[model samples]
Structure formats: structure tokens, C-alpha cells
Target: MKTFLILSFFALAVSALPLEESERINGENGWYLPQEDGSFEWVDMDVAEKWMEAQEQLESRGLTTVPVKFYLYTSSNPTKGTKITTTTNSIDASNFNAANPTRFVIHGWTQSYTASMNKDICSAWLSRGDYNVIVVDWSRARSVDYATSVMAVGATGKKVAAMINFLQSNYGMSLDNLYVIGHSLGAHVAGYAGKNTNGQVHTIVGLDPALPLFSYNKPNKRLNANDAWYVESIQTNGGSLGFLKPIGKGAFYPNGGQSQPGCGWDLTGSCSHGRSTIYYAEAVSVDNFGSIKCGDYQDAVSKECGSTYSGVRMGADTNAYMVDGDFYVPVNSEAPFGMIN
Candidate 1:
């Protein structure tokens, strides 16, 4: 028993997202579904990069064409709270109130609804109080190979944007209160969503935006300052899995954004990458990471960033205008990494 229906009414106006048919691209080397001709093939990282480099017509095939799924939660524990579902082409948010603050938490490659940082972030935000938390699980569009995930990001971003736009226009959702959070590859995904939204998205938080096949690329193709009114980036693993450049107007390079304090010598190169979510979750409890303004990594490493300018806290609660610049935040490397000044 549900009374409301979506996508059915707005079907005609949204031709950009053709929900009728969602066909994933296929190739040879990494990961893919079997084709109609009973052929199975995959593409390696190099081949995947080539596909990403290729010029596509319009990006993400326009909305619902990729079949993105949204899971909504208002409380920290989803088991105790009821869930609201929205399809790739619809905004069937029945119990949700559009006036309140909304946060869209997107997962990275090979991650599912419950697999990664999105859930932690949703819980952290809800633990504070009641808020709309939409966990975007785009598993249908994701594959085992990194390149496929990279190639699929554009289309995925569009659908997320379209869904938000539809909610804003039809349900009276406020765009100014919307915040998009994405980690690793999902970070770039949030950037695209913010970029495509109708009246300008309020904020976008990028936690260690994926570096491979994305960095040193065009601004439109990846996360950047223009994506939202206030774009904050928390970089954890520089030049490896996470990006090295400053994509956010408020960029915080924690401990030089690499070689996190507690990982030890064992390095598959994702420890610091995962730390972004951990630090972000803690920040949600309260942006207590007393980050200081600095000229660059050299100054920060020399303990000079803290002396030049007044320290600013990092997280969702940060005031955009008050803390807009490149910053450096020191961390413990273990749980409860950041300490307040």
C-alpha cells in the first residue's frame, strides 16, 4: 500500500532519461554481463581508460537510462526506521519532507547499498537528528573493473541530478538545502550531479575523489569548484587512489593527504583512501578537526599553517564563506583522528 506513483506522470517531459531500456556497455578484459549473442568479455584498466577518453555524445545517456536506485533513511539505524525507495526515473519520496535538509550519499566502485562509507555517513548524520539521507546505490552501472566505473560515472551523475531536479520542481524540494557527498569515484560522481542540477546545488563534499583516469582531465569531466556554491574536498591519498589537485574551494589536505598515521607498512594503497570516510563521519558528529589555513604543504609540514591564519573547522557544519581556502588538518591516523584546537 502505497498511494503515490512517480516517473509515470513525468515520463513525457524527461526524454533525457529513458527508463524503458537500460543497456550496459560491454567490451573485452575486466568485467561485463553476457551479451545476447552468448558472448562474455571484459576490458582491462588500459582499455577502460581508452573508453573513458573516448568522446561520448551527451554523457550518461540522459537520466533513467542507466537504472540508478535510491534508498532513503531518516534515522541512524535503518532496521529501526522505515525505508523510502526512489527509482532511477522517479521521486517516490512519500514519507520524506522536502523542506528539511537532504543529503545524498553516493558509494564508490564495486560497492552496494550497505557495503561502504555512504551508510556510515548516513548513520552519522541521522544520529545527530532527523534528516533526509538518500544512499545512491548504482550497482547496476558499476563493474569489477575500475575503467567501467569511471566510464559509467557521467551517466550516473545525470540520473542523480535529474532525480533531484524533479524533486525540486514537482515536490517543492529546496535546492539550497541539498548536499551531495561522494567518496573516491563517488566523489567525482557528486561533482557531476551538482554541476547538472537545475538551479545550482548548494554544496558538494568530495572525500578522496578518485585519481585514476580522472585527474588532470577537463573540469566538466571531474569534480571542481564550479560544481556547487560551496565545494569542500577532503583528500586522503594523493597521487594514488585519491586525487592530488585542489578541487574544492575549501580543500583540506590532511597530513599531506597520504601515508596515514596508523596503516603501518602494509600498503595496497587504499588505507588512506578509506580514511576519508572515517574522518568525514567524525566531522559530522561535529567538524572538530581544527584545520588551519596554509600556503601549501611545505608550510603546513613545517608547522607554519597554524600560525598564519585563524583556524577553521572542517565538515558539513563549516560556514562556506568563513572557511573558503586551502587548509591543512593534522590527524592521529587511528580512530578519532582529528582533535579540536
Candidate 2:
């Protein structure tokens, strides 16, 4: 009778602990926000509430008008970006090449063309190949309140779609060669652009798509597989600043997708969240960001991928054919983050 009572107590204690122990990267803790699909994600309550209020305001007042500007970069002019407009022969006037692969790098809230996301990605693409890198500068929408920036996603996305349409119609740039990459709030902007374009965009890469206001949002509102022909995501700060679950056909969870290595004691998860873009930028230049397919996020968190499952590259050269599951890729704490095969 004593043995039975002790066993029951032990079982209860184990059950009380967090389900996935591997997810607690960087030693961060927070409220567990329940997802629509009955799953729960750890999120900072303050940030979550701000986004929730923003979403509510957005639903009530509709999307706000945002002034979006485009800047083009190429190998010829890597540093100096040529301003491009949707109207009046801007593509023909600028150094826009329709033959090369085109990449649109959209920055997150409080970021502009000068942000590392735009500069580093542009430099990486140029170093890899002669690509057309267009930096979407929507800093005009930024305000003191982060919620106001959330409301501007829709309008900014429409402008991006309009620019895409203008390029396709007038400059003969094929959607097959287009890739839209966005980080944080910009990820949702990419989704909106893809939706506006009727999901005709070739690929959309979401780097740690913001979770605060977007975790419980509908597929049409957030970044999802239906947003593009091939949609993928790299979750660095999942369950906090970033969405916890797989938001795309190909979802990558590096270091459990919660906190990243080298980002020690990240209470707000900004360091880990920024790692998404950093990893992606490096992946664009190097072919070593390898990832193994997993049965689910649980498998990823445990680093015990099924041998039957195949591995795929987690960057610019990701396999479009092998998708539809979670992928786990280990990285170093510092530079040369990709692990050798």
C-alpha cells in the first residue's frame, strides 16, 4: 500500500512538469498561450497583449494606409540602392534585370532599408549570384506604438503586390523566379503580398514570423503554405516573439525553435529572434545549412529524427519537392552557424 501511494505521487509530480523539456532553450519562461489547434505556446504576456490590442484595433478600424518605398540593389551597385517606384517605368529606368532571380527583402517593425536584414541579405545574394535584390522600405508606417505598425501590414503588402504586378506586366519578370523574404512583422506582410498575388509567388521565406498578434490569426491573415507556391519558415524564437508551430509546408526548428545558442538568458527573445535572419543570410551564401526532417516538433525538440525521413537544405536552395513536415538543424553558437554534413 505504501509503494502504490509513493508511485502515484511520483507520477503526479512528473505530470506537473512541462511536457517538452527540450523546448526550454536559453532558460526563458513565460505564459503558455493556447493555440487554436489545442496546442499551447509560451509567450511573453506583455508583448502578447500589445499585439492583441493592435489586432483588435485593426479589425475595428480596418487597415491603415502606409507609404511604402522600394530600393533596388545589384552586383554593380551593391552599396548604393536605386529607388524604384510602381508607377512610370521605374523598372525600365532602374538597374532592374528581369532575367536574373529576384528577391524582395522586407524588414520588420522599426526597420528600414538601412537595417541589416536588407543590407546583409542583399550582400549575401549578390555574393552568391547576380540577383535582383529589392529592399522594401516601409519605415513610414512605424510609430511609437508597436500596435500602429501592426495595422499597417495590410497596406504595405498591397504596395508590394502592386510593385510585383507592375514588374510582371511591364518588365516580363516571371513569378517563377521571384522570392519574397520577410522577418517578424514583415513575414505577415509577405503573406499578404502572396495572397494579393493569388498565391502565384514562387516562394515566400518567413524568418521567425511574429507570434504576439499573429499566433491565433487565420491562415489568410498570417504566413502559411497557401500564401505561396512554396512557403517555408525558420523559427528561431518560437513560443515567444515567433510563432511556435510550423507555419509553412517546410518549417525549420533550429535549437528547438525557441531560444538560440549564444543568446544566453534571453528573457524577451530578441537575440534568438534575430538569429532567424542571420542564419538565413548566411544560408544564402553557404550550402551547409543542412536539416533533417522530423515526424513533428516533438521529434525536432528531442533531436531524434527518424532515419526513414530525409534531410533538406534550410536556406535559399531549399528543396521544394521534399516538404510538409518539421525539420531540425543544429547550429553553432557563433559565426559559421551551419553544421558540417
Candidate 3:
């Protein structure tokens, strides 16, 4: 009997070993693959030249172009005992010829795609026409908890501020045109950047800002609109893992904030979590045809409402809300109005 009991215990222990090992591997691997030495080797002068050509094409169409500068940052995976390197790249206004163009920055969430990927995706928009777009690719350690991610965002926020200052002092860009756009965890990063900028930026657009972990109740010391005049817009789709509330100047929802078919709520689809092709096109349309009549651009929300735009939806409980009237301005004056609810 004693021997049988011992054998049973041994069997259970052996069975659990694989589970433990898998967990360890997951921790070591982080949420994504560790950056190999050759990861960024693909980026060089030749690639940059091609990128420049693409920018030129967009400029030919009267679109402003912003040059992209990729910077790498290293962080350790807490779960997996390995070192990972991530790159954060920024797009500058000099690439685009606007006297003093507004700076638009994008941020992503956990397991969010790499900055290079974002650069590739953003290139499409950059080629469309004139606009200064910057992407903040911060070091995102895999599976790093919400708190750790927030810290990373806060640190990057300082870096963004430095970059803005550099652009203003060296490149002669106006700080008033600066804008920040974040998705999921990137939304939290935008919040941090806005807090650090002290209201220098003109607007912030959050796409389905993560809920639960990165929600408004998370006690973020760096979360708040820096200036009363600073406009913030939040659009949530699918069930993001945060405690979302109506805080921005205008919070628009297309399908009542539920995940759409084309927009990948997580990462398992044609489009990642950040910006979907459908959402991108919709955003472009909104930028072009939306209205800005309301005090904080509430009219813009109405413009995007009821359209068959593609993107993830937060859930059934979510509804679009706007805090101010002048959040979004219409690009085309002749476009129809009174559609969005």
C-alpha cells in the first residue's frame, strides 16, 4: 500500500512537469519572439531610399511626408529568462513639406506588432496626401503586466516630449499641431504622452483603448488631459480589456463599440490590433468629410456614425460619447452631414 501511494504521487508530479515547463518557456519567449541580432539588419540605407521614394509618391499627390527614424531599446522578459530587444521608430515632419505640420503619433499594446510593421502600414497613409505622421515604437517586453507596460509608456512619453521639443527648436515645427493616436496599450501610452507634454499637443485619438488593466481607474498618475483646451478623442471597438468611460472630447463608436469582422480585436486576423485597413480608410474618410461644428467636434462623431466602416467592437454595453464639440474637423466642406449618432 505504501509503495502504491508513493508511485501515485510520483506520477502526478511527472504529469505536472510539462505544464510548468511550458509556462517557463512562455515567460522566456515573452509575448513575442526575442529580437535577434539580425532583426534590424534589414533596415539600411537602401531600404531607407525606397521608403523615401514612397514618401515622394505620396507628396506628388499633395500629401505631406514625415521621415521615419527607427530606434532600438532592450528589455528583459520577466517570465522567460532571456533578453529581448525592441525598436521604437519616430516619423518626423521634415519628410513632409508643411510649413508647420501637425505631428501625429501612433502607439500599440501588448504583443502589438513591431514598429517596422507599423512603418510599413503607415506608409500607405503617408502616401495618400499631406500629413505628418509619427509612430512611437517603444520597447514592449512580452507579457509584461499592465503596470510594467504603463511604466514603459511613461518613459517613452518623456522621449516623445524630447522629440517634440527637438522638432520645435531645431526643425521649426509648431507644438500646437502635435497629435497622438494610440490603440489598446498604445492608448495608455498616449495618455502618458499627453500628461508629459503638458498640453502642447492639439489632440489625442485613442482606438479601442485597452480596458480592465489600463482603464481610467488604474491610478495612472500620468493619465489626464494636460490642458483644458487640449482635445482628446477616444474610439473603442470590441471588448478591450480596460474600464472605458466617456472622457475624451468625442468618443465615437461605429457598431456600438463591438468588434467588427475585419478588425482584429486580438492579433489573429488579417489586421492587427492597432489599425485595420477598413478603420484606416474610415479614419481617412472622417478626416476628409467629417464635420467640426460642435463645441468639441461632436459633429464629427455624428458624421462617422451608422457607416459600414470596418474595425473591432468593444461589446454590447459600450456606446460612443463625446466630451467636447471641436474634437474632429471635417476635411471636405461639401461632404454630407447628420449621419453618425
TM-score of each model, paired residue for residue: 0.78, 0.81, 0.50
lDDT, candidate 2, 1-341, per-residue tens:
22443344334434444435555431133344323333445534334444455444644575444788999999888999999998667777788888988999999876788998788889989998788999999974455344456667877888899999888887788898799999998999999999887339989999999875564446776889888888999999877778878888889988878889999987667789899999998988886677878889878877788544355778746566657779998889999998756
RMSD of model 2, in Å? 11.0
lDDT-best of 1 and 2: 2
Worst 10 residues of 1 by lDDT: 1-10
Model 1 pairs in collision: 28-42, 28-43, 29-42, 29-43, 30-42, 30-43, 60-155
lDDT of 1 at 243: 69
Write model 1 residue lDDT over 1-341, tens digit each, in one string.
Answer: 00111122123224334222234322212233222233333323344344444424323343223557777777544533334443423345344667668889888866776765776788788888778888888864355445445666877898789878877877788888789999887888898898788988888999988766564446888989889989999988766667666778888877877657787763545678788888999899766787778887556444467543356777847556676777778888677888687
Model 2 worst lDDT run, 10 consecutive residues: 25-34
Off by over 4 Å in 3: 1-100, 111-121, 141-147, 215-230, 261-281, 285-341
Residue 29 Cα positional deviation in candidate 2, in Å, after optimal superposition: 16
Best by TM-score: 2
